[model samples]
Target: MGMKVGIIGCGSITKFRHAPEYRANPHVDEIVFFDRNLQRAKELAQQFGGRSVETIEELFNDPTIVAVSDCSSNEAHHINTAQALLHGKHVLCEKPLAISVKHAEEILKAQAASGKKLMVDHNQRFTKAHQKAKEIIDKKELGEVLTFKSSFGHQGPESWGVDKSNATWFFKKERSHSGVAGDLGIHKIDLIHFLLDDEIEDVHAFYAALDKVDENGKPIEVCDNVVCALKTKKGRLGTASFSWTYYGSEDNSTTIYCQKGILKIYHHPEHQLIVETKDGAVIKYELEPIQTNENQTSSGVIDAFIDCIIHDKEPSVTGQQALASLKVIEKILGENGI
Candidate 1:
C-alpha cells in the first residue's frame, strides 16, 4: 500500500512544489491538505484530487497519514513539525527549520524523542548544476576547494504572496525573523554545506535595510540585504550575500575556487556551468532543462522524502542538518543585533 501523506500549509510553496509533486507520485496513496485559510486548502485539495483538512489537529489524528509536510510560515515550522512527529508521523519541513536556534533545537529534541524522520526541503542541493559541481569537487578536480562565493537574491516576497497585504509578514522581524538572510541566505548556507561537505566554524556578517519602508513610512525592522564571510571547520574560506531588494531579475549563482581550477554555476543562465583550470583550460556544460510549475521548480526533494519513508532510509537533508544552517542564520542575526 502507498504511504498516506498530509500537507500542513496551503501557501505558494505548497501550491507550486509539494502538492503537484505528491499528486504525481504513485507511492503517495492519499493527500490531505490543511491551511489556516480553509478555502485555500479546499481549493488546492480539489485541484490535486486530495481531501481538505480543516485543522492541523484533525490531520494528525488520522491514522492513515504516515507523514506531514510543514510548509507554514517560518514562525510556525517548529510547532507544526513537532506536533506531527509527536503524532508518529514523519515530517518534511521547509527551509530554515525554525526562526531561532533555540526553537530549532526544541524541534530537534522532539524529533529525537519521537524517533520519527524530519527532513528539510533544501532543494537547491538536488539541482543538476549543484550535483555536477559536487561530483567534480569530490573527485578533487577542483583540487581542495580553497574558497567559495555564493549568493541567492530576488525581487522580494510581495512578488510571490497571494494576500499582498499592507503588512507583509516577511517585513516584520517578529513573524519572519530576519528578512533576506532568512529567506534567501539560508539556501546558500545549505548549498555551501552540501557542496563542501563541511560545517561552518564561525561567521562575521553585516546586514542593512537599504530600501524598505512600512505603511507609515517607517523603516522596516528586517534587513533587505546581508553579507557574510565564513570559515569552515576544515579550513575552507567562503563569502556569501543575499538580498531581497534586487529590483532586477532573480540572481542565484555560485563560484568555487580550488587549488587547481574554478567552477561557476549560474541558475538564471539555466544551470550553465563554466570551468577554468589553473592552466587556462576552459570547459562549459549546458545542463538539461529543468521542469518548473507555477514559477517554482519541483525537483527530487519530494520524491526523495517519499523514498526515505518507503525504504526506511534517511532523507537527503535531515532536520539536524537544517538546524546547522539555522544556527548560522541565528549567529548572523545575533551579531547584527536583530
Candidate 2:
C-alpha cells in the first residue's frame, strides 16, 4: 500500500536526499512539504509534483501522513521532531538529533509516548564500505581493532548549501549550534560508534574557525575546523577531524588498525576497502565511489526509514543512537563541561 509522507524542511538535505528519495520510493504515494520559507516548499512541491503546506499543523492535521522527514535546521530538530512524533507520525530526523542530550531525550520521550519510529540520518552506516568493514570486524577477520583515524571534510557549506552563499546557517553558531563538530564531526562519531559497536567514553578536542568567511567578508562565527581524540567504552582509541576548509577533493575516509590486520576505507578510489595483514598479505575490495558533496548518491537512509515503517520495525538509526553520537559531539564542542 502506498503511504503519504511529510517533509519539514526544503533545504539542501530535503532537496538532495529526502524529497527525491521519497519521490522515487514506490511505497511513498505523496510528499507534503512545509518550510519556514513557504516559497521553497512551494517550489519543491511544484518540482516533485507534491503539495506545499503553509504550516506544520496543516501537514500534521492531514492525518494521512504516515511518516515525516525532519530536515529542518540543527536548532529546530528537537521541536519539529517531537511535535511530529506526538502527532503519531514516524520521524526521520537529520543528523545531531538535538543540540543537547537533554533535548534529544525529550524527543525520545515523545517517541515513546507516541510509539512511532524515530530515525536519524546518520547515512554513513548505510555505506557499502562501512557495512563491509563492520562485517569483517564482526567475523574477527581483523582481530581486535586497536587504533583508528577517521575524517570528514569539504569546501565548506557555502559551496554546498542551497544558497551557495557564506551566510548559510552552518556558519552561525546560533543556528548551526555546534558548527563543524555537529555538522560533520557527529557523522564520523556515529560512524565510529556503529563500526565499533561502542560509545565514546573519553574525549579531547580542539576546534576553530580557520578559513570560511561570511557575506560581510568577516570570518564565519562558528568553528570551521575541528580535531579530536576519542576513546570508546570498550577501550578502542581513535582520532577524528572535521573541516569545512578542505578546498581540495572532499576526504571522507577511515583507517582501522587491528591486531591482525588494518582496514582502510575510502582511502583509494579503485579499492575503496583494503585490508593489510600483519603477515604482509594485502587484500582489496572494490565498491562504489564514496558519496561526496559534489557527487550526489542514494544515501539509503530514506529507503530504510520507509521500510521500517512499512514493516513495523524499529528505525535503523534510532534516536537513542543518535543521542549517543550527539553527546560525543557535545563533549568535542566543550558543552556539558566535557
Candidate 3:
C-alpha cells in the first residue's frame, strides 16, 4: 500500500505542483485536499481525483493521511506544519519554513516531539545543474571553494498569482516578513549552504524597496531588492543578491570561485553550465529541456518528498537545513531594519 497524503493549501502551488505530482505518483495511494477557499479545494480535488476537506482540522483528523504538505503562505507555514506533525503525519513545507527563526524553531521542536519526518521544499538543490556542481566540488575538481555568489529573482508575484489581489499580500511585511529576500533570496542561501556544505557564520545585508508599490501612495514595506555578503564557517566568503524589479523574464544564476576552476549555472535563456579549469580546459554542459506539468518545479519537489515518506528515508532537503537558510534570512532582515 502507498502512503496517503494531504495538502493543506489548494492555492496556486497546489494547482500547479502538488496535486499533479501526487496524482502522477503511484506511491501516493490517496490525496486529501484542503483550503480556506472551499471552492478552490473542491475544484482541485475534482481535477486531481482526490477528496476535498473543508478545513485543515478535518484533514489532520483523518486517520488515513500519513503525510501532509504545507503550501500555505509564509506566515502559515509553522502553524500548518506543527498541526500536521502533532497529528502524527510527516510534513513537507515550502521554503523559508516560517516568517521568523522563532517560528521555524517551534516547528522543529514539534517535529522532534512527534518523531515525524519534516522536510523543506528547497527545490533548487535538486536541480540537475546544482547536483552536478556538488558532484564536481565533492570530487575536489574545484580545489577549495573559497568564494561563492548566487542570485534568484523574477518580475514580481503578480504574474504568477491566480488573482491580482493575491499579489497584494506579498507587499505587506506582516504577511511576507520581507519581500524579494525572503521570497527569492532564501533559495539562493539554501543552495549556497548545500553546494559548499558550509554554514553562514555572519551576514551583512542591504535592502531597498525601489519598486513594486500599489496604486495608493503607501510605501510597500517589503523590499524589492536585496544584497548581502556572508562569511562561512569554513572560511569561505560569499555574496548573494535578489530582486523583484528585474526587467527581464527571470534571472537565477550562481558562480563559484575556487583555486583550480570556476563554475557557473544559468537558469534563463538556457539552463547551462560553464567551467574553466586551471589547465586551460573549458567545458560546457547544456541542460536538457525541462518538462513541467502545470507546476513543474513544485511537482518535482513533491515527488521527492513522497518518495522520502514511503521509503522512510531522509529528505534531500531536511527542515534543519532549511532552518540554516532561514537564519541567514533573519540576519539580513535584522541588519536592514526590515
Better of 1 and 2 by TM-score: 2
User: Could you give the C-alpha RMSD of every candidate to the true structure, in order shown?
Assistant: 1.8, 1.2, 2.1
lDDT of model 2 at residue 24?
Answer: 94
Evaluate all candidate structures by whole-model CA lDDT and list the values in order.
Answer: 0.86, 0.91, 0.82
Q: Is candidate 2 or candidate 3 better by lDDT?
A: 2
Please rank every candidate by TM-score, starting with the best.
2, 1, 3
lDDT of 1 by residue, 1-338 (tens): 88789999898789888999998898997889999999999999999989998888999999889999999988998899999999999999998799888889989998999999999998888888889999999999868999999888777786676665436778888888879888889988999999999988799998988887866778889998999999999999999999888788677889999999899888446447788899999888888444322256668899999999888998899987898998888878775533
Each candidate's clash count: 0, 0, 0
Between the candidate structures 1 and 3, which one is better when assessed by TM-score?
1
Model 3 global lDDT (CA atoms, 0 to 1): 0.82
TM-score of 2: 0.98
lDDT of 1 at 119: 94
Q: Report the lDDT tens digits of candidate 2 across residue range 1-338.
A: 79999999899889988999999999999999999999999999999989999999998887899999999998898899999999989999998899788889999999999999999999999999999999999898878889999999988888889999998998887788888888899999999999988899899988888888888999887888999899988999999999999989989999999999899999998898999999999999997887887888998999999999888998899988999998888788775322
The CA root-mean-square deviation of candidate 3, after full C-alpha superposition on the true structure, stands at 2.1
User: How high is the lDDT of residue 46 in model 2?
Assistant: 96
Please provide, for model 3 over 126-241, each residue's C-alpha lDDT reduced to its tens digit, 9 standing for 90 to 100. 77778888989889887999898887777777666666552466787777877788888998888898998899979988898887775476667888899999999999998898
Candidate 1 stretches greater than 4 Å from native: 267-271, 289-294, 335-338
